[model samples]
Target: MPIRTEIVSQDRIVYQGDADMVVLPGIDGVMGILPNHSPVLTALQYGIITVRLKGEEYYFTVAGGFVEVQPDQVTVLADAAENVAEIDVARAEAAKTRAEEMLKEGIPSDQDRYLMIQAALRRSTLRIDAVRRYQQGRRSRG
Candidate 1:
């Protein structure tokens, strides 16, 4: 039996499918969930989420989120999330650069602005890394 997995960001549902396994970046560490797994509710860290079905896998970059796992379903409510295949590497690199530049220019007077920039840096970095680590093979194959 496959688990029903849904990954939803603030704006829309990024992915909804049945998977043999789901790996999440939990706050404490990475956790893998399979069908008929015990229930869990946890905060997620900024990292990659992996969904495996059959012999294939799909990857997504998630920037902070909450995951609820039940015996037959896993739902992710992410602050921001995107499929690695959909990511624009150049765009992510540019955003990472902008965030780094802002930080190097000196901390912002507004704390919220600083946090926002940091968050952007984290998200962009996660997206870039996810693509590098997971999307390359798919691209080469295609």
Candidate 2:
């Protein structure tokens, strides 16, 4: 059986198609969905979302969102979302370095800035993980 999945952000629809399974980063924890799943809705936290279709896999980094699962469909609406192919490795690396520097500074007096930096770190790390996995696949094929 095939399950329909869609990933949407505030500004755009990042992905939409058929999938065999989906692993989502939920607020409470990670959740997996397959065809004919019971309907449910849950808040999302900053993390990665993985979708499997046929024999292929796809990955996306999402910064918070809500997921709704119906009998045959899964929809994720995120504050922001990016796929591995869409990620800029250089930008993600820079953000990771900047976040590390901010953390080393002891978070200072700005709580919001600290949290923002932390979120950036998480997002960047997710991207890096996905990209690295893709690179590994390329290496094996080469």
User: The CA-based lDDT of model 1 is what?
Assistant: 0.90
lDDT of 1 at 41: 96
Best by TM-score: 1
lDDT per residue as tens, model 1, 1-142: 9999999999999889899999999999999999999999999999988888887888888998899999999999999989888899999999999999999999999999999999999889888888889865442100
Q: How high is the lDDT of residue 63 in model 2?
A: 88
Reference-based lDDT, each prediction: 0.90, 0.84
User: Candidate 2 residues 1-142, lDDT tens each?
Assistant: 8998999989988888888999999988999999999999999987778888777777787889799999899999998888766788999899899999889978768878877888888888877876887654321100
User: What TM-score does model 1 achieve against the real structure?
Assistant: 0.94
Mark the 10 consecutive residues where model 2 has the least summed lDDT.
133-142
TM-score of each: 0.94, 0.83
Clashing pairs in 1: none
